[model samples]
Target chain A: MTNETETEQTPEHVPMMQQILDNPFLLLFLGVTIPTVLYILWGVMEVASIPLAD
Target chain B: MTAETVVGVGRRAAAADFRTCPYTGLKVDAAAQTLIKANAVAAVVFLLIGGLMGLLVALTRWPAVHLLPADWFYLVLTGHGANVLLFWIIFFEIAVLYFASAVLLNCRLPAPKFAWLGFALMVVGAIITNVVVLQGESSVMFTSYPPMMAKPNFYLGLILFAVGALIGCAIFFATLAIAKQERTYEGSIPLVTFGALTAAIIAVFTIASGAIILIPTWLWSLGLIGEIDPLMYKVVWWAMGHSSQQINVSAHVSIWYMVGALLLGAKPLSEKVSRTAFFLYILFLQLASAHHLLAEPGLTASWKIVNTSYMMYLAVLGSMIHGLTVPGSIEAAQRKNGYDKGVFEWLRKAPWGNPAFAGMFLSLVMFGFIGGISGVVLGTEQLNVLMHNTIYVPGHFHGTVVTGTTLAFMAGTYLVLPLIFQREIVWPKLAKIQPYLFGIGAAGISLFMMGAGTLGVARRHWDITFSDAELSFAHSAGAFLMMGLNGVFAILAALGGAIYVLVVVGTVLFGKKITAGHKLTFPLHAGGGAAVSQYGSHATTKLPGTIVLVAIFFVCFVLYYFINWKYLSELWLFR
Candidate 1:
């Protein structure tokens, strides 16, 4: 029963790349800003990228 | 009683003033007990303040019902971190240092006046810091990284507190030397005292680092100095910041063994092994501070990789050794008492009703499983980016510092009230349940916050929802659920903390007094010196039940470790 539960929890054969792209931020970082420093607050998009109150 | 009386007399004659605990057979100095009481009372007051601030912070993080305004939330967060992390824990540690040296070794406290001076400075500093934070405008969180500055008084308050703690450490060392000259215990010092000594040494290093960074920053805040480099500030500051928690680790691990000895008549499975682990902590543990700077740009990849990978694992090894031997010792003792049926019959029969045992055992398990495993994960260079500056960071520390250290300290206090204060515990039923309530609730808060952080919620943001931001980001349904649940558990933990405060305060003020030489009718088991052995002649050495538990822990650790690696790998296509 324990072995079966372990097997069930482990991811079965979905492509790892597909899993990575599920988070939109990672996809944006890899596709657009791979060479640049990926600082969201330093002006990629207009407005405060970070929720930090100045 | 008088200063002249204590000063002129030979050290052996000073023993005339000491009274022996009838239960534990350890001599207690009256001055040490008074200092312990004062520090403990102060520690609980700060816990109440910090715990209330924590509840408000938790509620504000809950997206569906954000409680505090952004300004108020930041202010409270600053107060919460300072009081709980710095003031509460350090005050209690000074008390522990005195107890381990003077009381356990059965000697007079050298320079009682210096101890009182340290206590007065600490009390004044804690009050000043709190007052300045509440006065509004110093919302720079615990890491008051300048470019952003708090009031000059905020910096001054911290410096004063550190100097006071340094004095306490000096007194602890002097007492140890006096104990040696006076010939208190034979062979080496007790393992608990050795652990405390390790903490004191680390604290001195930590306090010096703080003084180096904070003094210049204080001048900058006063506009007497020009510029404070942010990177330079962070590098020096975490030497104190991270090592402060390391102090907690040593002290609480000592208490783990103490509670075990008190409750189960346990001994360290091997005193040499246990002492060696503490030695490793002294040598390599503070190197783990480099993990805080891993994602910073100023440091090189080689520096980060070496510090986080090789040297950091040595520190990890020290903790892992402690994790195994502490419970293993208890299991070995129980088996000797003839509970050696199945793998866990000894564990099953162990005293669940004793609040001290229950709190310490729960602290050990939660710390190992939640704090230890998560700490190793977050320290990894590649994996840290995913959780860095997220609620996961707070989640991880609350596991270590709150559930682990604070819970263990609370457990130690249960023994202290009866043992030192000569007072019976008030509301015995509430005291018994307090650990479970706090531990379980704290565990929930940790797990749920980590869950939210995994789903990419920000830390230190007043609102997780991006409600005030121009670009509003929507978090996953799971993140919302996790945060809402975190709020619920925070309330539960606060209730548990309230029970502790009420019980401790009521008992200290008005409970029935047990005269120091008499036996108690409460939770602490009535056991003499044989019951509190750190080593033994009995050789029934197998700890199969503890071995099984250790195996289960390793399984959980391995699975969680790999899962984080997989998460990191997904963040980059090549790496």
Candidate 2:
């Protein structure tokens, strides 16, 4: 039974190389740039200043 | 699919040898496998002991209910808290160190013998300490705050363990040096390895402080030295304790990123943002330890104000930044899925059913809301008088440490186990359930504990309200709530923990072998592929990105220390 299930769900070895190439900008913005900016903001900001602002 | 089915699929793709890589000297040897297995086993044993100790302490405080004999209760509580929080966690940290340095770095350990020696020393120290405490001779609380001394062995045992840990840290550094000299990889260290390296840096400072404080305490215990200044020792001790806590925090944040990436096929919300947060921790975490001593005497008002108001603000900002980035990464991942639009669309469409993801998410939220809030409040010099040394402090940490950090580690372990060990987990079903049960139970305990803490309930005691019975009826109500909730939570968490233990045990011992080269399938949202390009272009460039970040942090460190030094000179010396 286990063998049947194993054979049934063989993982597709889809190389992400092409997708990465297609949308390079979106990838860069989400993965690298944003985190970098956030880090700068965090270093500068004072915690007591952030209002609940709800 | 069941373990059997997974194994079958893996068998077809299995590399000729699962234990070794021909190209790289990474992966465990058959003998090394035994050591790694032993480390994991020891970690779980300590976890159970710690959990039980927590239970005793929690039960005793719940409405002042004394389950154990009053005489022996405090002793058990102290041992339990120290062993669980420090010993168990450090043991796990060593396991993580091994994984990051060797397994993740794709290199063999430089000195396996020293690594084993470190483990042995730590174990011997822990055993001696536990034995002494259980014999009812050493009742000093977790901090074993001097002036209230424990038996000689207890302090000696602690110092030995810390020394062993220092050796372990040394081995980690040695391993990294070898990797660099050998040019283990063409480009930068992997992100997980980078995070672990940062943690190792923090541990260096942490253990140095520990040696300074503990060695002196050891001498004092043996009558070999005159009185160590209690106030100075307090300051130095917290330098170790609090900074060590930050190491856990930084490590957990890294694990959070890993868990999200591995489980959900998510990219960091932003690599730069996450890396920046990691750097901020190195800058701000050490200074913030002074917040713990706000209510203590002999510190000038200006010192307390600067430490509490300025430094804690930076630390809080670091946490808040992470608070935003962690969720933002998840949201970006969900957005990639193109889920239906709603106010809570991201929350609704999230893979809530995946225990690993859910557990990680909840842990982050609880840490931010409960732990972070309590931390800010308690760190206030004025507020410290109300909450210092109270149940609230422990509650805050439990929320952060147990929920935020340990849960993430456990979740990551479940995901990584099959890949690391090359053995199928014994009970996949139980593995899935364990995180939620433990997280929920822990969160419940934290909530009750915080409530009690707000009432100025003292921690590190069997019965909270001493003599005068300053606790109001409402306070008593909160205590009962804490006790009852924690009791239920403890059982649930233990049950879940037991299942995890069984799964780990079975995998190491009785579980069937799996074929090598088995790749775990991570579901990709549309944006998942985007991260590959992002990381490849920015982070994967050949200049050692992590080392560059560390260097940048050191520059900031110099500036920070210079400023603090000037301030200290003016306040203490010139004044």
Candidate 3:
């Protein structure tokens, strides 16, 4: 069978994304990245995250 | 010719019987071959030089041995660092650029003359800077931190080299544009080309940042401008330096995909997934560069925290996604095709015996597990103090740069050599062993040095201790042991490099000359049609003596390090 049909048929698997809610490895990676992401998000939410001062 | 004749001519030209195998697209004119050969030679020379420098640094850090003289130590260190890290890897990238655009995409480089000009300028620039550093005119490390100045020529050479690289990138994009306008490929670019194109795009931005910083710095050096801001220059420099590094990372990852596809016939697990990973690099790589400045005094707490923590996390996510996708694709391919039923079926069924496949595999594993882990930890804000400018930094990069990027390039060379040169390798056995020796050695050294760095070992020094401070004898002993082990690895790598040189040289000079139409086959295999499928087509009979000479020059570079060490030992001894 051609690659196109196989790709179309295969179901999506978001194992990491799913596991991020629970799995230790996933959580550890997420725990580190999430806080940083949120911190950046917090600043961006206030204004653009540029310049030294708020 | 009539319009009909013109159409017919176009079709025939398109269908021209080039002797390159279907996989590698190595078929090209002598002129193109000359350009590619020149780039490859420069790349290999830089790779060996870089790898040797890496080994020396590792030796000093790992076993805490003072392998060279105290006075000239930092100068050699900086030269070694810049030559190998920036020069070697990027030269290979240029070679890759030539291959991807001209050969792989089946399009002539839009301006071959400009490309040659770029290459010439880079060579001249690199040589000047390298020579200046060797003479102890400057030892600013690879970063070339200003305030701690070098000769004016050093900065000028750096700017010229970067400008030349910019021209090469411009050529790459122009070629791509022409290919698109001319409708070179049937549909979307083949996966490899697509990946390379992404790398090229990243390179455009990366080089721009480099130029922005380096050009200003050069002017400042000449006193053409007064008072350049060191902080601002550093920030901008990282924009280039970090992004250029990302280009390597992105290209290496793409090569992982290619290696998987070509060697194991593995398809990307999810095409969209892989593409997304490449895209994430474009988004996150530049931002992540801020992590390099985490421990610096001037940067605000908020700035450092956000850049190191937040930006780095996103970068890590991109890397993690890729870490999953590359192997996933290979696994999916192996499983889908019904390879074997062992517990570790994928591993068991994999063509582990094939040097190209094995080398690619080891490179991927090393980069992902070792390099990836170190990257995350070092990028963390608190962890930066422990690792920054320490032996760990070099250790971490060696895992990625030498073992990861260089190994993939070597594997690609092995697969493409016959198609490019139309000659069988002189020593396939030794050729296969080279990557393993190099990769294992690199990993050992990186691991050992990282351990040393954790114990607070400084980098770019002839001694482990700070002046007037008592040294940790136990830590120093561990560092020495690692360095001694690294020396062994270096010797192995050199041996592997020797075999590669011999193979290329023998193939070019004395191997039985075969014509373009000759069917290529692996000596050991016959009926499987697998080996033949990969290499049998696109054989061309051509004298590659010049190419072989270029290869020899690179080999000699590795030899030079050892010879230099012999003399350098008289000045300073590890013992």
Candidate 4:
């Protein structure tokens, strides 16, 4: 994934997400993060729907 | 080179490459290092989440500060149990397996890709389970008992995790085989690796039991199966549940020895005796699962007696042997280094400033004194009935799992960061004090919980005050005080845990890196090579200090064991 030609051709700074994706450890974090965010959203929705008892 | 030769060449190149620790001179394969890092990182993350949940649970139990609502209390309790008990520990155990097998044996990992697959499955499964638990439909509180059902994904997630762990176990075995075939080290494996081998073997049995039970539970959750017998489910489930802690006992005991060696350059006092103890664990440890089912009416007395008395004693004997030999080994090593004055001189001369040594020694003492002794008492059929579903059960496990296993893992991480990751530990001052802070707080938590349990605090109930119940019951005021103190100690322990996390994460992310072949400047493990595996000569160099400690342990164990019996006797007098 580390390409010498590509680096030489594009000598500008890369985006932060691209840098994170390049690192395997950071990718592992991302793998867990997506599902966690979705789960949190789902949890918020579920709790919102619960009606208060009289 | 051709494509075939290119692949072959890469394989050969990686296999030929190894890095030797400048301090210990042990060879570490690159791929094994990757797996260890991945697993250890995941373990610490779970520890953070679990510790937070535990703090909430403790505060909720406090009478003066009933924190979370009942629903949230049960939910957080369930998450705490799953993350800390299963996820945090097993992830670290996988790391330990890789380190003990491939790194210790000086062999390359046989299937690095397959190992990654296992890691991915485990990560996915753990996330799935956490997600489901947070969804609030799966707060069955770790046990997920038959009559109370959780989402099917909860059971499915657990099954996937178990299968992933089974794959990791298989890789450990295969790595061992590769070491043997390649003749990496002569004779039998090292004692620490042997201990890890015991844990892995027990893991195989434990995971098999989990699969056997969780598979059906998954089906039942999906409505594919009829009613599951609650008693039958409990019997088989504990075979998975309690036996999993048996895996923890084996792994952390192994870490005790490993950290002893890394810190003090200590060897097992008698390598043969220690290895035999590990062997004893593999043979009889799973039978200790009977303690969880001791109060179940469905199980026959004969069955209970055989497991708790006949076989479980052997498991306890195994732990007793480890309790003696680990500190005995440290004392023997210290004496050999000419600290040969009085009984406590070797102990006094030990490198207590080193966090690794301090954490390990505290773990050993607390584990043997409180955890081991209380565990045996709680395991007894007669005494167990008094405190079966009470707060005492969690008290006993917190002593073992948190104080014993988690502390050992934390101690092991100190050395691991410097040695394996080649990072100079940041926050050295805080690192030095972290162990004691954690140890004192965790010990306080355990003692107060046990005290509360003794005064009739219910285990799973969120409110100690029976304000909502029709038939109200009142516990002693001391129990409320104990719960309050438990909350304070839990906060202290969480602070300690946070300090550890900051020190480790900060060091790994930004600390000075040691180049390959450069000697590490860390003062941990500053002793000479004279103590590394010093076997067969001056084996028993007058460890009166360890003898006294062991004697103290036994005396305390006897007192506690009988006190429980006395309490049981007072319940119904024949007079």
Candidate 5:
């Protein structure tokens, strides 16, 4: 809740968790980037470095 | 002044192309509504085609039946995998994404024309792929591994489909921004919308992966390149192929929560906990793609262990959280309604008659017990070695994708008709029983297929009998019996699917209109979500029933894991 709605009396108050939750862009960025690094990028690196079969 | 009355598009309904739902009071936009309807209708049409193809494939796999010829079997199997797994599911998901952002948030959809273009591209792409598969030249199966090349159009179809999906994800994100900037709802988005956000984020990653691999493969198919490395294609393709399962989970989990919320007035046991789980859910599910590559010698031991074994469990844990919380919240709400006699009274008194509840619960249970637990075993590098090419692999995915994800979507449609389409559902009796019929049948298909696979039935063979070969060998009698049972279950599941299509399509076409003050055919729980529906008190609600259910799940998981290891040891010891 914000002063616009102003349910709580705490001035300019929004929990850090609430702020993060409200930010869809930030969530999308982290969600896409994290998985890419851990899964796709990591797997690509390994595949790129695969030595020729003996 | 109630939270429920703060409509999304209805906020500015005087000027915009928005209408308020007579039942739920959410502001619905005409553009969003049309998009949702088109995508959903397309999804169902694909489902009908794909499901029939699956039935043919299953009958062909059953030696006693062997419905299709070898070439036709491979062709239908290819179409089945792509249609049901890719097209049907993604189309429905795009609909959900639109609904969650635009309707739930009470915001207008941005760039409606572009969204239509995206949908057209997807439909066109799906048609092209299906046409190519039907042409008898490109039966590479769903994975489409290299050297076994398909026509360039096949890969091109998939790439276009991926691009369309990416656009859909973008529209969802854009809708979210419009909602926030315009101040549709206060504080954080609803938990259902948050879950949708998780799914769309994953969709982007999954589609991007498809683009990365499929574009090159498309060129190779055209002879623009000499060849694609088998190992490289295998690894990257699994990223595109297997990781899409995560998209299904994320989307269907959103559906579960949405269904639970709408039908049963169920809220999560802990909002923060469940959202955290969704965060962990998508993050780790991508890592679980490593299981597909576990058998590849080119990938090392340490890589498989860290990614497949350790990190994959995080995905399992996320699902486990959802599995527990969904029912826990439901139980809490049920008990709140004065069904609080004992541990199981809430469970016993649930709306088992409602297709939505029944389907959602069945999906959650099947996904967790049969799908998730077995997945844990198969995702292990050592266990994967035993199960990799066996029919058990199909069995496991059948459990997840079919019973888990597909059933969830099927159940959600019961509600989708009235809410989105604003039409009454016909055939109340059939609607009541469709979930059980489909669920039991599909679960049987998964379990029996797994049973045969465990006995070392080959996964990728049109003929296990080898009737044409010079030398004929036979699997154990038990393997044959399990497959025979699989055929039977496929028939039952197909029956249920037909009923679903009839009821949904029939209702939308001819059922009574849901105008303002219309009597809703299937009654919703009166009032808003069981917002404060926690048991005991708000702080430390005790979910005794859910806790007991989860304990049983853990016991089953541990027992199954050890059993696989013991089975592995027996092979070596006996030989």
Candidate 6:
């Protein structure tokens, strides 16, 4: 519980994963964005794989 | 922050004041409790309706009974799916979201009026859909795949429901904000709440996908638009359908954690790892919606493989982590309580007599061994061909949804009765036996369905016997027997479900009221002191018993997964 706004401060070490986990909003962004990209890619690949009709 | 200074001293909202629960010493907001009560009661009503519809569907599938005619069978099946899969689960999950956010956090809910509006819309939508289904104009089945369009009201009803649920999710997020801004509690939220948050996040995406697909489909149904491509419908539709089930997984898993802490004062062996697993779910869980698309053409193998495996099954890795940690936490708790004699003593000495514990434990085993293993098999692109559109599909979900998620919900309902509803369980003796009755019957339904499926039982077909066909087709004797057994199991499961409804409704209606001074149904309840310190440094706690159980699970998973491949290979080999 180090103070960041104070003039003299002692910072605590936090792991990157813990930082992400601690912030639900960050995790929410990744959760939604990642899946949306994957889904679009899946749809795009399917459309691309289709042969042009004669 | 003393929960008074950072937050207003009192009267945030007209209904925002909190009363501390006598059992747990947690502050319960009046508005939030009312909403929880409303949503939970609605969930039970829908469960009764859906469970009965399921019984009818099962009986019709049984071949021996063949209860309903074709039209009615499809109608009831759709109702069963909509009511149980969508309505019952989502309504309860709304209650869960509120409970997890406000009740668990000891904060006042921000918008009680909006929450009620959401609950009202859900109820209205569910009723509208059920009415539409029963009117015999909409038998499009649960999938309601495009081109086989139902009445426009059916789609309309579903849209209303999704909108309502989305509102519920909004209220939940807002409540979380209020908690944070008010400084209700310090540090990270509890694991149970984290798990609920995961469910809520996925739920938003799922309901949005539903809105995207259903709104257009509804317009199409009304002749207001052009044709909907079947393939496109399947893709977007399962984004909603499959992801909705993912919400269930997250919610029920949260309940499992809550129950563990409540019952045994259990703490997770590794909070970091468990939270990481939930994070993995958020990232990759919805991508597994591709499992349904595996059998469809025009989708490339790369797309199929990448998505269905959830990017190397990272989502599955999430579930596996939960599977280990939930019970491991309980084991660790038991050890702390001096049940450390051997590998099995913790499990052995745990309260099996407690319906909540028994049902949750059964749900864990069945979900992992049967549901988890079967799901991976079904998810495999190559192997899915063997079981695609077969009874095996339903079999797999029954393992997960019914035996796993639904059973977990029922188990948690016991706690809800004692804690939230403030009622002692009626027929305490019957309550004790309910979990086993339900668990075994559900396990039977899953197994028998899979057996019948392996012998090539069609999923949505009206009759397996083909009595009126031009060329009379016959399933093997074993398949016939398995369907018969499925019917038997359905009755058993119905009895189990009936017992639940009877006891719960009876308890809610007629049971003695708890005034907090009285002992709870579980006299030994730890009163939630365990939740305060839910994480441990001991990620590597020795649990040889759990190791052996996990080994057996891995073995079963490997064996069953390959056997499907073996069956698939048999299909291609030319003699």
Sliding window of 10 residues with minimal summed lDDT for model 1 chain B: B1-10
Model 5 per-residue lDDT tens digits across residues B119-174: 99999999999999999889999999888999999999998888998899999999
- The parts of candidate 4 lying over 4 Å away from their true place are A1-54, B1-16, B516-538
lDDT of each: 0.80, 0.63, 0.62, 0.79, 0.84, 0.85
Q: After superposition, which runs of candidate 1 have C-alpha atoms over 4 Å from their true positions?
A: A1-54, B1-16, B516-540
Candidate 2 lDDT (Cα, whole model)?
0.63
Question: With candidate 4 superimposed using the best TM-score fit, by how many Å does residue B336's alpha carbon deviate from the native?
Answer: 1.6
**What TM-score would each prediction reach against the true structure?**
0.88, 0.76, 0.77, 0.88, 0.95, 0.95
Error of 1 at B539 (Å): 5.7
lDDT of 6 by residue, B224-288 (tens): 99888777788889889999999999999998888888888776777788888898889889888
lDDT of candidate 6 at residue B422, scale 0 to 100: 80
The best candidate by DockQ is 5
- Candidate 6 displacement at residue A11 in angstroms: 3.7
DockQ numbers for every candidate?
A: 0.01, 0.02, 0.04, 0.01, 0.47, 0.45
What does candidate 3's lDDT look like per residue over B25-111, in tens digits? 334434445567777777776666655665565445433355666656677678777787678777778777766665655555666
**Which consecutive 10 residues in model 2 chain B have the weakest lDDT in total?**
B1-10
The list of candidate 2 runs beyond 4 A from truth reads A1-54, B1-36, B337-350, B464-479, B517-575
Error of 3 at B122 (Å): 1.5
TM-scores for chain B, listed for all candidates = 0.96, 0.82, 0.82, 0.95, 0.96, 0.96
Tens digits of lDDT, candidate 1, B68-186: 99999999999999999999999999988988878767778888889999988888888999999999899999999878999999999999999999999889988877776776644
Model 2 per-residue lDDT at B300: 57
Off by over 4 Å in 5: A1-18, B1-15, B528-540, B573-575
Candidate 2 structure quality by residue, lDDT tens digits, B1-575: 01000001121112212355321223443433444555666777887787777777666655445677676678778877777677877777777766666554444566677878888988988888888888876887777777877788888788778887877777777666655555444334444555666676667667777787888898888888877766666777876787777777777776676666555455655555565566556555666677777776556556567666786677677777677666665555555556536535766767666656777777787777667666676676765666678877888888877887778767666644554565666666776677778888888878777766665566766654454456543346656566567667766766666676677777677755655544333222333222321242122222232233335534554564355345445545543
